[model samples]
Target chain A: MATKDILSPLPGTFYRKPSPDAAPYKNEGDVVKKGDVIGLIEVMKSFHEVQSDADGTIASFVAENEEPVMAGQPLITLNI
Target chain B: MTRKVNTLFIANRGEIAVRIIRAAKELRLKTVQAHSVADTESLAVKLADVAVNIGSPAASKSYLNVEAVVAAAVASGADAVHPGYGFLAENARFAEAVEAAGLIFVGPTPHQIRMMGDKVSALEAAIAAGVPTVPGSRGRVETPEDAAKVVELTGFPVMIKASAGGGGRGIRVANSRDEFDRLMPQASAEALAAFGDGGLYIEKFVASARHVEVQVLGDGYDVVHFFERECSLQRRRQKVWEEAPAAMLPEDVRARLCQSAVNLAKAVNYRGAGTIEYLYDETTRDFYFLEMNTRIQVEHPVTEMITGFDLVREMIRIAMGERLRMRQSDIVMRGHAIECRINAEDPAKGFMPAPGTIESLTIPGGAGVRFDTLLYQGYTVPPFYDSLLGKLIVWDENRDAALDRMQRALKELTIGGLKTTKPLHLALAADPDVRAARFDTQFLEAWLEHRAAMLEDH
Candidate 1:
């Protein structure tokens, strides 16, 4: 089976950390389980935690911190 | 508390802003309009006492920019802001920001807006207030496991909705466990895209239900319902045709329905005009609370016509902290009213948006007929905003008379240089089921498709 990249399900500003001073939830080369908190997407004062649906090692992070991401746009690549 | 709305700043564009400008003008209040670069030459800007350029065509830079709107209000020296329908109308933070700026947010309080903005929380409040809600999850599920748990408890064939979602986006139906599993990701993705909150909430889907809503006005203490409207005819969760006094409801049940709306509004200490929406199943004669819109709805005109009230003017009065001038007992339903949303869209071409300059325009005029529009000859319908060009409302003594008036008014309306859904609306008015009010929410879409197929057959 081919490894798939996790994409943003909505359009918003993506934040890697919960807060500016907090540690990132997941980093490069980190092993992640299904439903693991990947990052938060802020839309109109609401923060939504974007979760990973596949178990894998992080191949790459496609979105930058505080960057705007579109729906179905790749957020992070996962190596199964 | 005494409030003075000397100057009003409208924080939206298109026909709604124009409508607000007219109402403000009638009230002798100076109107200040903020427009994006695209809407600079629109009718609203032309009619306003003064105009300010905010940003580019992208809504984020103009309408959705709370700071920009507040800055415009401050710069224009306006004492109040009127968020016309969409954008920041129901946004609690925006309301708070407006209040923080020491400007009157001409709607409900931030607390009220926040309480009603969340669907799950709003349902809980409705239940607590003795408002009947549909059989579904009592609260929102945070995880897929939680959603599965709720599904197992409530059984299958449930709907997954976004807590922050509105306008029919971020909703998916699943009939089986496999379907639920497959649809969860897509729905979550959609919810995230639409509302920025992929927080999915599950509810039992009520099929073949009539979309009815009660219009209510409140003064932060007393609340009164102004009867109900049947908005069963819809396309993609947006109301297309609305009629006052639902045709199929029993008299006692209708009274109870309207009263329930009043109770909920009072429970929240809601101010200004709001709508209490419900899903009514005709077969079972059961109704359930759907949601409360804490702003003036597009279909307010129909209710106003039937009840002989100026809802917009009431909103302005309510915003000024004036007590509701009329009581529930004083209100009397006089006539049947119907409104058809006239949009710049071609129904024959999959309802494609047809935006262009109006080469010719002739609006119908007569007693018992009203057209709330901003379109004029030589005016261009912009593609940036919603396709709705105007609303055609007609009132008569009875449903049949109202239907005849609407049909006649629609036939008389003329707008060239762009296609519209008028042809489709005319055809629907002629349908037997529609005339009898036997149609449900899905009637319009299916009927349009059926018409398309018949056209193909011909």
Candidate 2:
């Protein structure tokens, strides 16, 4: 097994769901594909999607939802 | 009889917070800065007589948290709360909360805030006050049949607006009868989904209009006008530049427009500093009341420059239960003043907000020029708030001179390690149409599109 970490590209509040009422884009033990949105980073009142760069499966999110995140901080870990 | 405000609490952040602190200090009132965790080192916090961390960085947990803000104000022993421009400035419930907690809300009464805060009610009040309003439905158009009736009177092009919508949101314009029928239902559904209100209103769509607003101050008994501001230059319905004593407004029309604003404020027995916004049709030379902001606005400094009055100080005094201090004739508009909103966004890249540490800062200064900012060397602008880094305001004897001064000041401002909208303002200052004072509400977005295409060719 190979492990990799997805890093946040911006410094802001990270959200796992598209909106407050919506389900999270990804969860632990969920399979993900490249270019799949896993979270959103809200910066300066604007939202940007954080996409997975590689195919992975069944890992864990390092950064919690609605928490402040910094650029280059690890947001999720994946097993390939 | 007036209750003096010995301590003032600022329940907002950014340049406005700093602006309030300065005004309070000038009045010899203690300033307590209520800030989020992310703004611990903000210039406002640094400059205040005291500081309190209300909650986390997200505004929902701090600035907009009515309970938290009110508790913080009480705990800080602050007698009055200034909500600034955003956050809870217009939230009537928040104003009520502050007052219920034995503290003064530095704005109008909650009833007045609620009245002006609603689109439908605000329009009704405008009509009742004898202020000219856009020809449309009397109140919320409940159904398509009712909307059709309004369109009959409003003509071909009409606007379908959500009574709960604001900041240019939840609006659909129909240019023809067919378009109106098709869009009316969709707009209603969207408004319900967005604002939980299916209520809608109709208004005559002014094809070529300018965004002119009159500044008024009231003490719950009397109201006075500070002339008008032209904020037609906007991007995404957000004002980018503002000028006081709207350029080329016929003196007679200006007088009528200003008096109308005072009429509305008196109707509400309005307190504190407020702005009565209007849509002015330059071709017809007719003006209609748009809405009233029951709080101090972002472009207030331009009015201050043209008329040497400290609006912030006046609002604080009004909050302390003081009566109207100045008469209508005492306030005079002397010169042309312009204000450019400097945001921490990249102008070339669709205004992508860039939040970073300020490595160096070169502030513009001289006679009749002021840069109101919450920035300092080594300050890290948090990515949590609006992109407004500061406002660069300039004043001169005439419009032409003010424009020249704005160009010079924009050139002198420099911020390191951050992308800003400085380039955008520079281009606007150089543009011939802008210099000639020829633009309407829809001008800047179209101008931005044209500028983007030009940039792509290069």
Candidate 3:
């Protein structure tokens, strides 16, 4: 299996859940198709969605939920 | 309200953080820096006695998080919090939060901030205190017709300003009836986008005015002014170079300007450090109250250099409820001081921000030169905040000497990686008008245009 890393496009707080009351968009080991949002990056009080580019199963999340991330930092590792 | 502040928590970052930490160290106080995770390796964190991670790097969850900052102060056993120039520095809610957590907020009270934060209210307050203000709309003007009424009364060439705005974000000048009609809606749109307030007000536009500000320190009732600083050399209304003991202000005019500032401070029963900005029409020798900044300003170092007083330290003392130690008569401006705001932005290519790592750094030193900065060799300039990399300030026996030192200092100072306004500062230092002190608030835009045109011809 080939592992691909999903990198953040912006530097800010990484969020896995869509909202506080909702569950995370994806969990480790969950199968995600192309265009599926894996996490969100919050910068300057705005949220930007980080979507997967290829269909794969999530191997692991490199950045923890609510963790601060830099541009191009790995957010999730996917097994393609 | 005098409370002992042993452990001080710094609730901001960048040069101001470094500034506060140094002041606290001098005062023999333990310091804690509440930083975002991204700024863990910042210079301020390195110098602080303790560092606490408040939240993620996003300012909303970290520096601007009133609750997180208050919690960090209490959790770190900090007795006081210094909200530096930006972030939550002017936030009244943050001040209340710090006080609610039983810690001293090192600035003005929440009420004073609330009163002055809104431009319309500040104008009304200034008038109540007998401070001279530009004639303008008595209230918020939303429509062009209402703005026309104000423009008609104030006469031709009036300024439309945002009711809730600062830092020169929401301002437009109209010279004629057609211009006024076109600018009224344009100014309102910018005001709404910048301040979340579409409300506008028109004021009599005093042409070719100098931007001068007076530094004032107050403890409830007693207030004192630290002379004035001429900040007329600006670009897009951004102050680039500032000098103190305003050049060529008549003796009586200086007295009246300083006195009016004191009167305003007394009117507000202001506390801590503040600056009263004025637009001086050099041609007429008349000055109008522009606005009052409730927090310690970025350009405070110029005033300090001339007055020989540590404004930040004095602010901390004032927050501790101590009476102002100096009287108006006791304070006298000495010599001359000028400050250059060194930003990590290029003058050409439309002043684009160039954030990167500094591979090498050279800071100028010697008598009469001071550099206040957080830049260290190999340190990365983060893109999340202000472009101000540092401020190079110099003091001398007179303006010419100070200008000469600044030019030399500018030549000696270097940051290896980023494109800075250094080149522009050098050119302005040698510009004929700048050297002769012949400029106003409207000077820089035209200067830059002329400089660019000259460059093209070459």
**What is the C-alpha lDDT profile of model 1 across B1-458, one tens digit per residue?**
86988999999887788888988889999999999887888889999999999986657778999888888888899998999798999999999999999999889999999989997689889998999888766666788888888888767678888888866677788989999999988888887887788887898777788999999999898998899999999987789899998989899889989999999999989999999999998877878999999999888988989898888888888888899999999888987999999888777767656667899999999999999987989997665567889999999999999899889998899988888878877877888998988899888888877785332100
* Descending-DockQ candidate ranking: 2, 3, 1
At residue B212, what lDDT does model 2 achieve?
Answer: 97
Model 3: DockQ score: 0.15
Ranking by lDDT: 2, 3, 1
Clashing pairs for predicted structure model 2, backbone only = none
DockQ values of all predictions: 0.03, 0.87, 0.15
Candidate 2 TM-score versus the reference: 0.93
Docking class of 3: incorrect
Question: Each model's TM-score?
Answer: 0.77, 0.93, 0.80
**Residue B327 lDDT in candidate 1:** 92
Predict model 2's lDDT versus the native.
0.92
State the TM-score for model 3.
0.80
lDDT of 3 by residue, B307-389 (tens): 89999998888887789988888888899999999987767756766667899999999999999998999898765666788
Name model 3 segments beyond 4 Å from true.
A1-80, B140-155, B159-202, B452-458
Off by over 4 Å in 2: B139-152, B159-202, B453-458
Name the candidate that leads on lDDT: 2
